[model samples]
Target: MKIYTLEELQEQDVKDVIQIEIDWSMAYYGKEEIYKLSQEISKCFNLDYLIINLKGNSIGNEYLGLLAQNITKCTKIYNLELILEWNSIWNQGIQKFGAQIQKLTNLINLSLDLRINSIRKEGALYLGQAISHFSKLQNLELFLGNNFVREGAVMLLLEIRKCQDIQRLALEFNLNSIDDNDLQQFGQNILNFKNLKEFSLDLKQNYELTSMAQSKLVNQIQKCQKLTCLKFCFENIDQDEEVYQQILNSLYKIKRLTFFQLSI
Candidate 1:
């Protein structure tokens, strides 16, 4: 494991380093303090990826959102993985600090968690729209069961398809009102990604509807000659073993395949 103490981080001037991680598990030093920390870190590292963790419950999301805004100013930041829990305060924080989230155009990968039960669907749509503006974003992970708009998510995927730079996608859906047609359309959009290599779908409670959704999905996915890794989880397996074996055998022959997983 890689560990850096605050004192150690303060002393090392790794100006050419491409990755940095900051863990704020201590007390809430507020936005200015966090901004100072971000500036210091940015000065020391020419970063391509950054992992920021607000470890303790000492601060609300507003402070963290402010911190994120400052960090986006780092010119070398291209990938960001943020781990945060949603609270009403944090939701308010993002709403108050609107454009900062949308300004991160260099970002290609982002991971975040929102408290689904509390956030309005409109809030999720706004965030989705913000993400769509990322010209280079290829991978996104959001943790909120039913808080996001089904069409917005699909729209984001369609938008990313237009970017033609996206290669990996992961989506998590709670018990939302999405049917086979939605899946079919989403699958069709994914096939348009000529360079796409990996896809993952996490649907919590739609097993019985998946097999009905499977044939179209599998067919569309198979059209991607460049795809190598696939992660799928569905509720039903109405197809027989022999037929599945045939499909698997043909899929294994794809030129880019090195990893494959299908769960029913």
Candidate 2:
């Protein structure tokens, strides 16, 4: 549980590190400062777990690419969590960042927070291709809420479906342009995740979702006999009581289900 600031990390030598948490949030560091810090952190060869919180940082494509390049050098990292919410990163930056992330083939648990960014379909596709490189990933939590992702969501889900060992997944795509057909495709891809136990899908504020789509999604999810915990948020959709009841009936079919939540 060791925490280090950018200044501290740059000044001292980190060795034999098992876990390290780097907090660059709220810091007014310039691009060069971030690049130097990233270079320093890349020297730690024994680091297994790394957490980086970059909330409120105005990191651009070049600096983000530099940091990602250094991160790719840390081959021993197993669990990686990055918080880059509220940044100015766009599609090109995301693509470069994802290219570097693909080098971390040893990663098992990955959590990426790119909420409130300017990711579009191209960015989502790049990120999805990068995610497909993690064949051994077990736990994944991705926050892409409030972005321009629509058909890109389906592309990302298709890549995630390739990870056969993924057990727990929490995806946040609220306030996007995901429609009924896109959600149905997502549900269809999810059926391939046989090892998935806990799953949460947040599609709130997607005005295109209707009762028919909700039923179709429920029918697909009911096939996941291994699911123990399930959550769905579909607020502002056009679902009625009958549709809601159908979703509940589908949930009842999962004998192993312990936790169930639905918001409309």
Candidate 3:
């Protein structure tokens, strides 16, 4: 079921709708509007999968948390994709969002895009802790691009250790001020995700990134002996052909890797 506009949120029966997609991206909505939307969404008691796009909606922080809480009323949700990019949902918003969604203990896959929001370390910590509560999570994609996580990004990884069932993961922290030191620990934490077979990490616009750091991280990633697919992205790196060749050589050592992509 697809609800394309807020006007379509009628006070009607939709309890049998197992899957719902609300595409409201780039639409303008205020606090009151979101609250009402939450009320309507909560009535979908049998929802098993939801894909809501509120990106660029100019929605503020105060109501998104409540929306998160209301969405969990479905109880049967195992897959959720919430896109809140280019909004003003700051740390407080993410904290509320994260805390409320932890109630979905059955979630197996989640894709949360809070890009370009003014989130800091505290929000990252809260979000990570909340996500760690999901014992059944396997596929996860979190895009916190253009925020201020920095070293805090590592905290998210540390918490992700709890979801050892993760097999496919995509984390984008582009323009997050993360440097080599932060990713070294980040690399170490991900190595323990023994079930991880497909992984994508995007560090584009992380100006401090260098070939050396990338090499080190690749070395660490290779330790995930089960990985068959890998993708790495970064800003154009200044390196000689030999340096690039060496990096490629290191990546080639991952014998199980069937698909490899490195974008510099």
| Cα deviation of 157, candidate 1, in Å | 1.8
The C-alpha TM-scores of every prediction are: 0.71, 0.96, 0.95
Indicate the residue-level lDDT of 28 in model 2.
67
Winning candidate number (lDDT): 2
The TM-score of candidate 2 is 0.96
Model 3 lDDT per residue over 164-209, tens place: 9999999999899998889789778998898999999999998887
Off by over 4 Å in 3: none
Taking all chains together, the TM-score of candidate 3 against the true structure is: 0.95
Residues 159-236 of candidate 2: C-alpha lDDT, one tens digit per residue: 878889999999999877888878879888999998999999898877787767877797788899999999888887
Instruction: Estimate candidate 2's alpha-carbon lDDT, on a 0 to 1 scale.
Output: 0.86
All candidates: CA RMSD in angstroms?
4.4, 1.4, 1.4
Q: Give, for candidate 1, the lowest lDDT window spanning 10 residues.
A: 85-94
- Model 2 Cα shift for residue 63 (angstroms): 1.7
Deviation from native of the Cα of residue 156 in model 3, angstroms? 0.8
Native-referenced Cα lDDT, model 1: 0.63
Superpose all Cα atoms of candidate 1 onto the true structure and report the RMSD in Å to 1 decimal. 4.4
* Candidate 1 per-residue lDDT over residues 59-167, each given as its tens digit: 4556656665666667667888765543333345545434566777788887765534344444555565667677787876766555534554465555556656778
Question: Model 3: how far is 188 from its true place, Å?
Answer: 0.6
lDDT order of candidates, top first: 2, 3, 1
* Cα displacement (Å) at residue 120, model 1: 5.2
